[model samples]
Target: MFTSQGPSLRELAVQALSSVERGYDLLAPKFDGTPFRTPDRMLDAVEEALAQEEGSFGSGLDLCCGTGAGLGMLRRLCRDRVTGVDVSAGMLAEAARAHPEGVDLVRADALALPERLWNTYDLAVSFGAFGHFLPAERPALFGGVHRALRPGGVFAFPVGAPIPVTSPLWWAVAGFDTAMRVRNAVWRPPFVMYYRTFPFGPVRTDLERAGFTVETLPLPPFGLREDGSPRWRLLLARKPAAQYG
Candidate 1:
């Protein structure tokens, strides 16, 4: 699923063996050519949904903003400044090159943002990076996002419906996770990407524990499954506008 301009199999193999940060650094330059980059259609769909729901936002943040794929969506939705944060300096550099102006790129771990960033943003969005976080890390990740957003601000991301057990995609993901487990057992600096870990039920619970009121809206453009459920839904988590003593 990669173009000739994308990383070669040997490059991808090397990346899979490296630490997440270093792997992304090696992958950053050729990222936009790979399937790993967030699809433009998905970005457009999310931007449309946010524009319709919130009209516009003051400032925006993109979490784990690898190569700043979601920066364009933030630019369309935010009237003020937009910021992108990632742990890989190389990815941030590539993002800066691509976006050039009207966006700020920060190299930082998303789970532990700087205190200066607390309550500073009106909206936040993330795309395609959640798989890199293990399930146990969700609470801290969501908590950091909650603390980064201003009161009444939104943190939104799209989640796909679970693959059916009968589907080939299910077996493919299961095999991949199993392979990752075996690889981590034998390898140093585990890559930490898994397809099946972030189900909606557990994710909603973590978001609630992090002090967000959560709801969802189906992205109609992706259409429905044979079972008539949405193929994808946007998770909208809102921090409360007021605090009670």
Candidate 2:
């Protein structure tokens, strides 16, 4: 769902046909007006969870940081500096406009970060960006986050409980994913956004392989589901202390 200020149908059609970077560039200006931006309530819960898990960080990084929505959370959790990296220059420009003072916006692909960034951050985060990545790319993306963090540093994000397969919401998401697959089959530069692609089990495995010790904490503020399971959980993963020079 989108607000009145969100992208028009023509604008959405344009974005859908472009490459992911260009699509996001076209979408950046009105991004916050869409449900695509992580909600403040979820952001607050993530901040609280980070505070409890890691206490505080010296410097923070936001991977695929779209329009710097998560920068405020990074600023609250980190003491020194907060950097936002994105592949879309348009998105980075918007981020610069929105977070002029406290944040640094870098235009770079998360899969191909600069060596100078390695081990430069104490905390790394991403919000509402994973769907853009294919499942096979998770290892590289997580590895980049690991590379960006200092030893004992963290990479955190909030993940929601899976929609029930019996529910209409499930059918809706499934149909959306199916349509995306069909579109990709017939299109160039596929827009890779799938809801069910990044399940927690495989994600934890990828994080572990990328050298992170992972844990999940319930976000109670978002409340529970019918079975008393949390509607969402915050993933807290730490890069292990360096073993050798």
C-alpha local distance difference test of each model: 0.93, 0.89
What is the per-residue lDDT of model 1 for residues 1-245, given as tens digits with 9 covering 90 to 100? 99988999999999999999999999999998899899999998999899999999999999999999999889989999899999998899999998999998888898899887788899999998998999889998999999999999999999999898999989999999999999999999999998988999999999999899999999999999999999999999999999310
Q: Model 1 off-target regions past 4 Å? A: none
Cα lDDT tens digits for candidate 2, 1-245:
99998999999999999889899999999988999888888888899988987798899999998888889889988899899999999899888998889888888889988888888998988988898889999998998888888898888899999888899999998999999999999999988888889999999999999889998899989899999999999888988887211
Q: Which candidate tops lDDT?
A: 1
TM-score of each: 0.98, 0.96
Which residue pairs show backbone clashes in model 2? Answer: none
Error of 1 at 135 (Å): 1.5
Which candidate number would show the highest TM-score if scored against the true structure? 1
